[model samples]
Target: MSPALALEDLAVERGGRRLLHGLNLTLMPGQAAVLTGPNGAGKTSLLRTIAGLQRPAAGRVRCQPDAIAYAGHADGVKSALTVSENLRFWAAVFGGDQIAPALAAMDLSALGDRLAGRLSAGQRRRLGLARLAVTGRPVWVLDEPTVSLDSRSADLFRAMLAAHLAGGGAAIIATHLDLGIEALRLELSEFAAPRDAAPLSGFDAAFA
Candidate 1:
């Protein structure tokens, strides 16, 4: 079987300047890779490049078409919609019909009828993560997925991720905190652009 995701000498550029270069990695089914680095190291850039949200300046990123589910810093939930409605919309958009299962996995059944806007930060994050299950994509690309989540919510996320991996799904996550899941660590600093180069600008730099 083909690898779930592959990168060959991948280079990422932002603001007309290169941030990451010469990155090569492959993730097979049921595997995970965690990205780690300090500010300006290009962790987010790498993830975005892999997610196809940003164009690479050089090299290639190869993955099965439409096989990726991405969850970024933004929750991507409509505040006016109820929790269940939000999941339903995503299910329709992603060509999946697993909203109920996703909600249950995220422990969000009780909040199904509540408006998303009224959810606390942790609740909102959980709802955002539930989209992954609804999509039923084989590969997940998440950036700081645990942000705003409390300890319990974080544990829930870990469990969900473990289940995904167990089911032959792969994940690439960029986070500073631990998820307590087995994953290979990919330090972006190893592929960071030269220091003499211009520093990364904007919010991407904050997370690096």
Candidate 2:
């Protein structure tokens, strides 16, 4: 079987300046990769490029269509929607029907009826992550997925990721904190552009 995701000599740029170049990696079923680097090292850029949210400057990123479910630094929860409502909406968008399972997996069953805006930061983060379970996609691209999560919630996330991999799913996570899950580490700094590269400015600096 083919790998779930592949990047070949891929290059990403921000502010008309290259941030990452000549990057190559492959993720197979039941595998995960954790991207680590200082801020502006292109970790987010790589994930965004893979998720098809941003175009790469060169080379290729290959994956099955609709295979990626991405969770960015910001929680994608609707403040007005209840926990259950948020999960249900995502399930419908992603062609999944796993709301109950997702809620249970994220340890959010008890908060089902609570409006998202009323939840604490950790709870909101959990709800954001629950969307991944409902996506039913084989490939996950998450940026700082554990941010704002307490130790227990982080542990829960590790367990969820492990289960997903065991079930033949793959994940690419960009996080500064240790995930407590077995995954190959990719240091984004190694792929950084040369010091002589043009400095990012204006709108491009936003991505940096």
Candidate 3:
């Protein structure tokens, strides 16, 4: 089978400084990928480029747009909406009824009627993760997915991820903590950032 996604010599630059360069990575169905690096290491920027939220300065990104789901640090939840309402909206966007199961998996089933704005930080993150499950996309690009999640919630998130992989889905996660999920490792330095650079596009070559 063809790879789910491929990044060939992808490069990215931001604020006139190089964030990533010559970064090559491949994600296959059922496999998980982790972008492990310290702050300012370009992990989020790399994921953003793959998700088409940002453009590479030089190389190219190739993937099936409909088969990918991208989530950033911001859950993007409407505080005024109820849990069920928030997921209902997402189901509309992804065109499916998978949100119910996602909500249950994230432990949000009981909070379906609760306003998202009133949710705790961890609760919000769980709702955000529920989208990944409901989208049923082949690849998931997540940035700090477990950031505000409490220990139990974080564990639940990891379990959901394992189930996702078992179902032939893949993930590319930019996180500071080890989710303990089986995954390939990719470091931004492997892409070779330019010294004293800005503008976020200098690392586009890795996307080729």
Candidate 4:
């Protein structure tokens, strides 16, 4: 099968500074990849570039932006909406009717009626993760997905991830925690951009 996502000689930059360069990677359907890196290793920036949240400095990402369901640092939920409503809103946007399944998967069924603003940190994170389910995208690219999750909540996340993979979806997770799943480990720091590297120019400069 063709890769769900592919990066060919990809370069990522943040704030006019190159972070990673000449990076080659591919994520196939029904598989997962974990980005292993230090704080300044450019994991988040690469993910943002793949998610189309940021423009890459050079090279190419071989996937449509819409095909990626990105869960970033922000919860991206409306505080006014309840747990179920939050999922419903995302479902409406992404053309899915799986809010109920998402709620159950994230262990948010018990808080279906609770406003997002009322949830604790862990609850909010779980709710954020649930957005991935309702997105209806083929690829899941998450950043620090289990930030505030406790043991049980982490287990729930693992089950949901496994379910996604089993159903032919792909995941690229940037995390430090061992979610107890086997995935290709991409050590981002290995591709650190050279300090003396010049920024992209001409045509590419426009997007940089």
| Worst window of 10 by summed lDDT in candidate 4 | 199-208
Weakest 10 consecutive residues of candidate 1 by summed lDDT? 199-208
Candidate 3 overall Cα lDDT vs. reference? Answer: 0.83
**lDDT values, one for every candidate:** 0.89, 0.89, 0.83, 0.89
- Cα TM-score per model: 0.92, 0.93, 0.91, 0.94
Model 2 lowest lDDT segment of ten: 199-208
Tens-digit per-residue lDDT, 1-208, candidate 3? 8788888888776655677877777788889888877788888778888888878866877777688799897897999899998898888888887677898899999999999999988899899889787776889889989899889999999899898888888889988778887899887666757676444434443452
Is 3 or 4 the stronger prediction by lDDT?
Answer: 4
lDDT of 2 at 133: 94
Model 2: residues >4 Å from true position, as ranges?
198-208
Check candidate 1 and list the clashing pairs: none
Better of 3 and 4 by TM-score: 4
**Residue pairs with clashing backbones, model 4:** none
Better of 1 and 3 by lDDT: 1
lDDT, residue 206, candidate 1: 54
